[model samples]
Target: MSEQEMFLLPPERPTISHLRMFLSDLAMQYHSLATAALNGDYHTSHTPFFTANGNIVGSTRLRALIHKFNTEFSDYMRGKGEKLKLVHSRFADPLIRSPESIFSLKKKKKASQAKHAGWNGYAIP
Candidate 1:
């Protein structure tokens, strides 16, 4: 082999205990990332959350885990589905559907109390 070429063995299969510990650590790391992401959403557009090597986080793996968590959490809440009810709507985009709509006079013409407004609420015809 050339001096620039090197061979490295793959990681060994972890034992059950080691696997548990590794998963626990990974879960904690993921939790911190999610919390930081949520907290930073309300603040500046930047965040200090990065790996020790200064690499950007939130890979496909992280996104998959987030989806999994959301799914599992929703499943867990299925037993409490009876307690929730339809809540009133809230203003989202001012230029789309609000009393103080902005942007332009055309926006005022385009704005409506109709269903096409920007909202996360349940849709009804």
Candidate 2:
């Protein structure tokens, strides 16, 4: 097998949680390296990957990749939050349960009773 194929192949499929954890670890390392560079603490031997001023060579591509990841991840999280809010709203009781006027008193009473009759007002049935 080719070197790329060998690297790509794994004995088992990794779980989503594991992949997220791995990415989180990588983000932490990246943050640490960036902070060290900003604080002038980063020191390295002469390498093609870095310049004399401790800046990464070809950093534009890296910045683009980081920006893309941030945008995608933020969008994903926002979508997830919206979905969760939708689901919660589907089963949630109204905050204004009390009757505003005498005309709505009976309806409000019925709704309150029905809410309490279910499992914490969130039962599907």
Candidate 3:
């Protein structure tokens, strides 16, 4: 091997635990923003939410994780290195079908199926 090759060190190792922690933080931040949006407090586009080093802190693990996730997900979606792309829809029909609709259907089914608390209430068996 050439001296340049020998001098080049491998990148630091990151494991599934790191990814999981990153995912957990991302989920928390997303949930926060979603709650805010649901409350009619969605941040405006002119606001700093879409910009780098905006109102949010920088140089943090969560930011790095988000950046990494965006890059990887974009690449994955575009089939950058891989030969395939995920066929899942990012957005679903809001009026005709939604997560709430699924939950409503489930509740209706449960109501029709059972009279006891196990099937009618929050408790699941």
Tens digit per residue, CA lDDT, model 2, 4-121: 9989975453798887887897798777666654454434321333353446544423454567799999999887755322223556556534334433866888897887785664
Where does model 2 exceed 4 Å of error? 1-4, 8-13, 44-125
Top lDDT model: 3
Residue 12 C-alpha lDDT in model 3: 41
- Candidate 1, residue 68: lDDT: 78
Which candidate number has the best TM-score? Answer: 2
Instruction: Write down the TM-score for model 1.
Output: 0.27
lDDT per model vs. reference = 0.55, 0.59, 0.60
Task: Give me the displacement of residue 89 in model 1, in angstroms.
Answer: 27
Candidate 3 weakest ten by summed lDDT? 42-51
lDDT of 1 at 110: 71
> Which digits, one per residue and each the tens of the lDDT, describe model 1 over residues 1-125?
65444445434546998778878988987776676555544122234443323444434234445777999989988866655343345754434453233346556567664546666677663
Cα deviation in Å at residue 80, candidate 1? 38
Cα distance off (Å), candidate 1, residue 42: 11
* Worst 10 contiguous positions by lDDT, candidate 1: 42-51
Report the candidate with higher TM-score, 1 versus 2. Answer: 2
For residue 123, give model 3's deviation from the true position in Å: 45
lDDT of 3 by residue, 26-109 (tens): 798877765544454435432344335766643333445567799999988787565533333658444435556667888988
Off by over 4 Å in 1: 1-13, 41-125
